[model samples]
Target: MRGHPVTAMHPDHYESPAGLYLHIPFCVAKCGYCAFTSYPCGNAPPPDYLVALRQQAERLARHPMVREQRFATLFVGGGTPTVYGGAELGGLIRECLTLFNFDPEPEVTVEANPNSVELAKLAALREAGVNRLSIGVQSFSDRLLRGIDRSHSRAEALAAVAAARSAGFANLNLDLIYGLPEQSLADWRETIAVALAQNPEHLALYGLSVEEGTPFHRRSEQGGLALPDEETVQEMEDFAYGQLATAGLPRYEISNFARAGRSSRHNENYWHNGNYLGLGAAAVSCLGHLRFRQVPEPERFVRLINDGAPPFIEMEALPPAAAFRETVIMALRMLEGIAVAELAARFGVTPQDYYGKTFVRLQAQGLLAVEDGFLRLTARALPVANQVLAELV
Candidate 1:
């Protein structure tokens, strides 16, 4: 079954997730700004890690919730999923498919670093049913790429895209980062121009965030980082929006742009607050009112899975209020905004009733607006979304 067959109940009452996320925590080299739970694995992933992943998939497949579910999207994201051999990665995908009842046209996506991807790997992944490729082309400037300690050169980034095209990957997303230290507006503009030249199906543009414990954070604390000024960063964002729109890739979410009908289904599921099962080291899963997070350390993850025990380090059953807040926060990230009636139906409380005066005040400040029946951030409010969203919580 593609999904649980519905009875006479309203469709909204039968909400079930159709998405899955697999985390690959192995990387050739950790980027300076990255704080994700990933570590260097040199030439290839540890063989044991693959075995653990398969075990985890098999265990989850037997779970009652998983058995009742039919996934329509499977996203293999990572610290560089391409670090594993193509055949190995394909085998993992096949294993997941066998363990889960996936849709015939499920959107399977894999993340790759430009330095590790090749024509052979791309072909292997394509043959394995991966229809989309999201390449980590963080910057087109060689100097900026080095500043972030990225392993891929600008040439390698371009070559990776060319190879994916040759391998018949028509759906591709190039990830770009702005607000890097020493990144000028012109540098960002040139990066956008080069990325647009490739005509990717999607673009994920994110501003650099100096997370604590990362190398970038340490450098900033030591007064060594020279990040662009706030005004310049805002200009860079505006420029990207304009340039991407002109290239026919319009912004569907705050940080993502896509060609018509090409937006990431897996990501959209997240934005809609849909349920998803995540597997592998440090993976997170959200089903119904409960959320679970796996152990961050790969070795520990493998040990627990091999021992036939749950690898989760933490599990929480969200209170109603907390779930409502999370749903609103995620839904607001989309340009389309959230339907107030739907939100009320899902949460058992209208946004205005819950947020009360703060909601009205934000609307009065022109930071938020209610058009038709939807509540959304205004254009001026998007740049300061964190501040605006904080008010609700």
Candidate 2:
């Protein structure tokens, strides 16, 4: 297999520890707006699902490339990992630790939903070496949650946060969504206020998008989904940026905010365009210049693993120039952005040499700026970041 050209130039950078991601595809119920690959399995994954996952892990753990590099982070995310019983989830974590080579101070995280998680589950995860807990508290309003077809209520969300705190997790992240149907600026303010009251170390804010094939998409096509106006949604974003900054959880990435030293290491690895190994159905992996994803269906993925077939159904081998552009685009999501000098050092290609006329045009439009050696989006360009990024890529 051909490696990234930069790997020869900077061997240490390519050989450094990679992040690990495990997908839990089981959920209690599918939300109306969700497009993630998930099966509504009532609560936990089937027994055979875990067996297939273990086989995949063992296979990867024995690979020469995987064994050579230590892992610095492990993120367990899914339809709802907390749906599994406390003891069961704890055992899974333990098995992963024994099967992989991890950094001495790895940051292990698991995503949970409010209705599926309790104090006992939280405590068990903490004991199993999960230092970070991210709870999907999409909204604090019961009405908004119901409108989106979330299984959890406002009370359950609040209790989940309190329970995580009591379980010895000091590092916590809350996920929130803005611009729901019939939601107002005042409603968004209340949601942010309630989230702040919990004193979480990190916050992830997302705007609701009507994706294809979702119920929301169908409603939008039929003119039935009463989504907030674009202007009101923009207002909500502005308010959240200022409010969270004042609360000392400033925006570190476009959608992620963190207190000092609390940024997610696993996610940061991605923003840096670093290597990562992903296991389970629909999970994606990036190593060197190769990117691939497992089969989207859980049942199919399990069968493939058991049948001794490679689970990846799609793969891409990016050329050096494409990979360079990808790295820059991903890094630009960070608030501090990518260091122009660092890129030149690692890739031996300066932004001026690579981007050329496009770079000059964006900088002239005041949409992109180089400040203190970093190429970052200016405040004026933040709201239109998607457009700006498309131009770069």
lDDT (Cα atoms) of all candidates against the true structure: 0.89, 0.88
- Residue 133, candidate 2: C-alpha displacement in angstroms: 0.6
TM of each candidate vs. truth: 0.95, 0.96
Clashing pairs in 1: none
1-393: candidate 1 lDDT, tens digit per residue: 011111121224426556888999989998999999899988868989988898889889899978988788999998888999899999999889778988888899999999899999999999998999999999999999999999889999999999999999999999999999999999999999999999999999999999999988999999999999999999999999999999999998999999999999999988877778999999999887689999999999999988999899999987767777788889889988898877766766777777777887888999888899998899888888889988876
Candidate 1 segments whose C-alpha is farther than 4 A from its true place? 1-16
lDDT of 2 by residue, 258-370 (tens): 99999999999899888999999999988777789999898999999999999999999877677777878999899899888778766777666678778888899999999
lDDT for 262 (candidate 1): 98
Question: Judged by lDDT, which candidate is best?
Answer: 1
Q: Least lDDT summed over 10 consecutive residues: which range in candidate 2?
A: 1-10
Clashing residue pairs in candidate 2, if any?
Answer: none
| Model 2 lDDT, full chain set | 0.88
Global lDDT for candidate 1? Answer: 0.89
